[model samples]
Target: MEFSGCWRNILSVAIAVVLLSLAPPLAHTARAQSQAPASSTSNENDIRAATVLFYAAFNSALHGDLAPMSAVWSHRPDVTSLSAAGGHAKGWNEVYAGFQNIARLYPGGNIEQRDMTIVAGKDMGYSVCIETGQLRSSEGPMVKFNQRATNIFRLEGGTWKLIHHHADSNLNEADVSASR
Candidate 1:
């Protein structure tokens, strides 16, 4: 009887731990559901604008200007990015630094979205697109950059702000940076 009671207690504790593990995501989902837009179309449209602003800021960064980038992104701890320069940056500071590195690596480029697709969920949205452009490398040579990219955004204070941006292409970090 003693051994059986101990096993039951262990089972109870295991169940409690599982429940606690699920709490954060469940709470987040509830908040998202409460704040979800009635119109998915409206959400998509808003996220479209956010994507446009993000790409605009991205292009500006290629031109060695980061001011616009700051305006489009959420300055939150969850912000993240995976850039062409070959690094995974997490948090706003790290992500911003990645953008700075892009500005340094390619002082000039214009990447335009092609074959784009956008999806919007409760308080969250994402866009997948093909990015095509010619970027001038740090060595002053122009190279074609074609990348599959994904941008994620979340509603913050009634504004859609970028939380993540990922881009991948053939050019490596060494090729992108002359100083490498």
Candidate 2:
């Protein structure tokens, strides 16, 4: 009985925290949706720019080169990233540091984007991508994973800069190796 009560309390708290964290973005989204123009040519261009950013960022991340990633980012404090490894790194400084560590650890890494789809709003856009690649590590055969990713971008000034990025690995037990 005590264990059940404890579990329930923990679950309730977790849900509350998640909802709280989501509140700001949910509100921002609501505002954007209500105010932004629907189906504009600039929106299409924003999507194309965002797509380029995605490819460049992934390429930089794979090479462990911060230069490419930094080029696409806004270089603002609000920039954030969610990694497939369940790690959260916020801001350009911290993000760069994290990637630097990764580069040190895995010198020869490659990332491939597959089945990528892009959608855009007036000043916001996102891409659905499947990333499959290998990280060359000192340990064994290296680490490889296939992930379906959604990357969010915001139009900062005239340039499309990455604002919020999220990636989730498929983790399918079946041989996703063939897709690579």
Candidate 3:
């Protein structure tokens, strides 16, 4: 009976040791699981707010205002933009130049975005949407535009800034000819 009692005590101690060894990893996993959803939710909210800021900047650009446009863009050499006019600009200098040209050619415009979908990760997010707008040309003609646009953003200094913008005019040869 004495030997059996000793054996039972040893077994109990071994079981407790095994459980204690597993506790840290199990606790860590539980903590991670609990935090995952909250992190995802926070990222989603941040991306949504950034998208709103992007549209505000876009509107400012449409009005031929460059200050908000400059603020909205990342201002990095790696930034890029593809205009709805089918022109591509790379780097900050080119992108800013393109906007300057836009301001000259298009005095003002009204852009409406629809069917937008945004996906975000830890430090980056993208939005795709259909854009329809009308711009007043310097020649006093109202030019209508329909485009499929995608905008990419990066988190910089706790603010989201546009890194890339690509937009397709969605105009065929016939449409171009008709516009001309």
Q: Which sections of candidate 1 miss by over 4 Å?
A: 1-38, 170-180
On residues 26-127, what C-alpha lDDT tens digit does candidate 1 reach at each position? 999998777665578799989888888888988988887899999999999988898766889999999998888888878887888776789998699999
The lDDT of each candidate is 0.85, 0.73, 0.81
The total number of steric clashes, by the backbone 3 Å criterion, in model 2 comes to: 0
Question: Residue 157 error for model 1, in Å?
Answer: 0.2
Best by TM-score: 3
Worst 10 residues of 3 by lDDT: 171-180
Preferred candidate (lDDT higher): 1 or 2: 1
Clashing pairs in model 1, backbone N/Cα/C closer than 3 A: none
Residue 8 error for model 1, in Å?
Answer: 51
Name the lDDT of candidate 1: 0.85
**Please, what are the lDDT tens digits per residue for candidate 3 over residues 114-161?**
667788777888887767778898888898777777889899999888
CA lDDT of 45 in candidate 1? 88
lDDT score for candidate 3 against the true structure: 0.81
TM-score of 2: 0.65
